[model samples]
Target: MQLTVFPAPTSPTANLDHGHDHGGCRTKALQTAEQLCNNRGVRLTPMRRQVLELIWESHRAIKAYDLLDRIKPTTGTAKPATVYRALDFLLEQGLIHKVESLNAFIGCSFSDHQHQQLLLTCIRCLEVEERPAAGVMEAIDRELEQAAFIIHHKAIEIHGICIRCAKHPPITATI
Candidate 1:
């Protein structure tokens, strides 16, 4: 499936809503995960589903520790290992991407694994937006090919302030 990439708003005051359906987006991600697991003959356990849901519930990237903390209240016995294992599974299945700089995980907006993606991270809000980076990948591949190198896994992260955060800076406290 092809995912449409939305360009950044040209004006600061633009509504910025490109017809995104939040609830539907979450549901679609879950459904895509389930379908992927089924196709691979792997089971998406209840714990995995719960973890995926938690990650999709927020647009911001989430650390594994934060996931464990959130799960603890519901499971009453959640552990870091449990969350990590779930994250590993999701990562292996390409259902999520790990942001190395932030040490956090974000649900993959695209289901296809044929291409690499570039993540735009907001330094202030810690929110992440994914955009297809086919051109970037192609350039990397060309350079790697010249060097006789191969890429097994790839994710590029660009740090910047999102338009929303740029337009309205976060409030600061005065001592």
Candidate 2:
């Protein structure tokens, strides 16, 4: 999966949600995170930040179940509701987005900006990633016009095995 571990310049800065952050990147993301939370009048509780951080740490999209496993405390365990609520809040704020096909979520790289997103999922590996497809919207518009239909916000996603998967068999079979 293409993780793009670091945030791009054009996107609203957020703490990396994946593996680990070093140097100034983490600081910038944390600052941005605080600002966003303040502006939205939402509390960035410890649990919430931890969840978001875990998502940022990996460049790849993460399933909620996997995330729960990652974030479960060493001493005790977190309940499903805990992870679900944090994810729900993050999604509501547009700080992250869900890839319906993969049943996974990724940090919103462009949280501070406005744009539509399209996801490309690797079917075999089940990796989820996104790219901006402004032109695709125009094509979609044409298709929709032919159907004489109106559309709401659209999240166009394609699912298939990626080149990596095609070249190298995964250790485990796909579900």
Error of 2 at 5 (Å): 25
TM-score of 1: 0.82
Cα lDDT tens digits, model 1, 1-175, are: 4443333332312223333446676788999899999999998999999999988875678889989988998999999999999999998888998999899999999865643589999876567899887788888889999999877887788999888767765555444
**Candidate 2 lDDT by residue in tens digits, 82-113:** 89999998887777788876688877766767
Model 1 residue runs over 4 Å out of place are 1-21, 113-115, 169-175
Task: Give the residue spans of candidate 2 off by over 4 A.
Answer: 1-30, 123-127, 145-148, 160-175
The 10-residue segment of model 2 with minimum total lDDT is: 4-13
Q: What is the Å distance of residue 43 in model 1 from its true position?
A: 0.6
Q: Tell me each candidate's TM-score.
A: 0.82, 0.68
Best by lDDT: 1
**Per-residue lDDT value at 141 in model 1:** 88
* C-alpha lDDT of residue 55 in model 2: 72
